[model samples]
Target: MRVGKKLFPYPVLNNSKNNSGFGDSNYQLMITITQNENYFIIEKAYVEVENQDIERMLADGRAKAIMVVECSATVFREKYEIGIEPKDISIPIGNLNDKVEISSFIYANQDIEHFNSNDFLEDFADFDFSIEKYDILAVDDGYTTKVVFDEDKDKKMSSIFSVIKSNNKDLNVMTVSSENKQIVIEMPSQYFDYHDNMKHNDNFQNIFFAIIAIPALTQCLQEIKECFSDVYSMDINEVMNDKTWFVSIANRYQAVFGTELTSDEFIDCNTYEVAQKLLNCGSTKAIEDFYNLLWNGRSDSDDE
Candidate 1:
């Protein structure tokens, strides 16, 4: 995405040497995304350029603005002109995955010889400079937002539990470590090998979630609850400042439920509620998927 810079020879709106004559002029572009059904909806896509000169240029058809959106994961790239095209667009979820970056820019649609704005700097007020086509007059880096579908969320259990393999033959079947931010669950070689091998299989993944992730998360939440038992006076953020996993889950909780819990609520909430918020009902989803996978497999075998 193009960012406003000092590449232009003349005093552009964003240039450091831009004259104050274009008083109180600013450029802002905002783009936000939301998900609905099978589409990623662009909730907002608008540019607010507070400059009369630029507005006049746009009105006179000298300048054109466009918003560009790209999602590398799905190899989707599209652009919409500010006034000429629809701003709020919907992209099929099939055409999107992971991070979506949006950027907007205003540029000269056609070359203009001896272009000079009335608000040019004092030294160059009377001077004129040739403007070339596609010369960026203004730009906003815009913003990036993530799109996580149900399938994607189901596969993101690793964020809450950092499961690793333990090579020591004498170690317990599983060990939980919270010394670092993430709650690391170390499993002996045999169990870890089984998990690692079948992690990609949808049915096996559902089974692992039902067996391993649920129990590990339950324990992790219990430890957090106990850690703050005596410090109910302090904020949860302060108490778990070092535990990034807690922060991750808290943010996810808010994203899923559209509300943040008070520190007291975090401490007082039951383990089941905490689990639901943290996992976005992932446990129930896993159970359903597991049943479906088993039932579908049996039916296929019976048909054969």
Candidate 2:
């Protein structure tokens, strides 16, 4: 049927006996927009009936009651229509919460030339439109992931401590306590052996240490392998075999030292080479033997 405007009426009941024999009844129409978008819109409108006047009208032989609805859309490119039916409208009286709800659907002719025209542009130029709810989904696969590396300064400094301790047993490395989320290393005398080591080898080892602190180590390793194929010739399987490679290295250091260092305490790439050399030569024992070397007693004959 061609869309046309029509009033859907409801009957009222009469309870009061008056000289005029008419009931004092009242009705109210309430309209609300629930959801709307570019293609289609849905709205809810209601009618309310109340009071004795409305009841008296229904008691009389009046078979119909009519309600007038008025609506307009800002966008002229889309033709909006309204539908009304007795089943679609309701009349509830007495209860403040009682309501008759009407549903409306506003659709556009997609094949029309003015489907998205600018006919209403000037009128609602500054109006802001918003939707209450929506759903979006990606139907196909293929997505990109990103990796970012922001160095943790505290971890870097902890690594430096482990590196220094691995080299010298007599050197005391002082660390300052901080309330903020930062690591501060303090030396009683800035002339500590560790500082001397850093001063001499900072250029080469800093880059190595930074790599170990990469946040996404797996991706970082892959990218490094691709870029430096010749330098990093180990296959991914061999590199990832913790039991055969990493554990063996850790065992070697522990065997020489008589004490095992925790994973976090173990020196990182920056000091790995130097630490290996020290462990190989028993530098830790040599540092402890300095007093014995200095205080070795003269021969008995020379004392005589």
Candidate 3:
């Protein structure tokens, strides 16, 4: 609505019944301005259903100004639904009870989409706005996954680009590495047991791989095996064999590789290195070895 030299915007009031007869504008935009210290604030911007008591609310010392907008049948919720801009404005007032809510009730509950916030600002309130759309970047993987957002995702070493890598449970398998940006992958190898309760088609840990995150770096399967083999040289006593899983890996290396690799050799190595060997050792053999180790470890502990 246009006042002497100012224009105020309001919600697209739908289905309002015009009562005051001024072009049947049909709705009212009620604004209560309050003062805190030296500045003025839009304490509340409400949609009043009726315009009967306008003079009484504004005539008081505390109330600043009120406007009536003609939209449809829409009204602001009673609990002061919308947020005001400028946080606090420059309208100084003498009303001590200016903070007290005048317009108590409104019509409906509306979201941010339904209302334009600029309308509530006082004439001097300066506001600026712009819109942003994200650009897409394609990885080597043929975009089977839906892209929620793909901008500035260089894993870590970037000041401009920012990407959110969430644990995407919608995928069959989740591939987490030591890196912050992990992938929801569906390869033949499964490294993480994060989805153990869920059923998946590719749960096989069939290849030895390291979860190294240098952009576009692929797995060096042979290097992983050498790390595991090098670990075989470690003394049996220094190895961390407190866990039950180590016994199985030691037993499995002896059974499948036909080499007397003790738990000290296997458990003493880094986790990724051991994971690589477990992957290259074939999923079937690794699972069988795990169970056998689990059982054999129990038997040995009981014997002692």
Candidate 4:
């Protein structure tokens, strides 16, 4: 199935401008969202695990590893949190099946729970694995495009990079590994921080959707629909319209003045008047700030 809700991109590395090469702290915490059936699994689980340690685990039969998952809500803000599961589940503790795809990039594949212990390690070839998606937002960095997936694939996706880096010359992205099944993206880390500036609200579902899932995500979805619609079937249009792909701009028109509301309540209204009335009740200033944040990627701007 397609990714259900808006995904909080995995391994949000907050880079310090002081160091060109991000230190150990930057790589320690990896966050991600994966769609499991009806709900989205928000995974903020990571550990500074060593390779040899991971190898040792494989030798044992447990086939399980430690992980820290804060199963919080991403898109459905007022709805649910991980559905009956604890919000802050401790590390070395996550759904084993879910961690298989992402562990390669983080713990270097040691966290993966192979079905067949004997045959699993033997079949650990890189390219042999099936398709996976990744998004990387390189925060205020220069362009370094190392596809790491395929040489030719890198060349083909050059236009995608061009689309993302169109307006800003200052924020260029280098190589982010996509082989681990993620939609890796790069953006200024301030976007992740709550107190960054025009952040009237702490929630960033809209901003993340706009900035990270742009031409890259939509383009990938388009290609998948065209090529595999007949083979691996899905309702491409329905999922795409899940507000996860909506391009939100901070405009007075879209805002409803004097209302404290959530997105679910907005979506559930019946009549045009109800919807319009709802829109007329929200904080226009917050929307304006969000708008600037999404497009400009600067929370602390002179506009507000």
Please, what is the whole-model Cα lDDT of each candidate in the order they appear? 0.68, 0.28, 0.29, 0.30
TM-score, cand. 4 vs. native: 0.20
Candidate 1 residue lDDT tens string, 111-175: 97887766665766888878889987766667766654456453344665778999899997788
Kindly report which residue stretches of model 2 are placed more than 4 angstroms away from their true locations once superposed: 1-131, 134-173, 176-183, 192-194, 197-304
The alpha-carbon deviation from the true structure for residue 286 of candidate 3, after best TM-score superposition, in angstroms, is 15
Model 1 segments more than 4 A misplaced? 2-9, 14-23, 30-32, 84-87, 120-127, 150-248, 251-304
Ranking by TM-score: 1, 4, 3, 2
Clashes of 3: 16
Q: Tell me how far the alpha carbon of residue 137 in candidate 3 is from the true structure, in angstroms, after superposition.
A: 76
Candidate 4: tens digits of C-alpha lDDT, residues 49-146: 22332235324622222232221221111211121122333222222222122221222222232211121222232322221222221121211111
Q: Which stretches of candidate 4 lie over 4 Å from their true place?
A: 1-181, 188-205, 214-216, 229-304
TM-score of each: 0.54, 0.16, 0.19, 0.20
Give residue 148's error in model 3 in angstroms: 47
35-143: candidate 3 lDDT, tens digit per residue:
4454435544544332322222223321223222221112211222322121222332222111122222122221222221332234323443221111100001100
lDDT agreement of model 1 with the native: 0.68
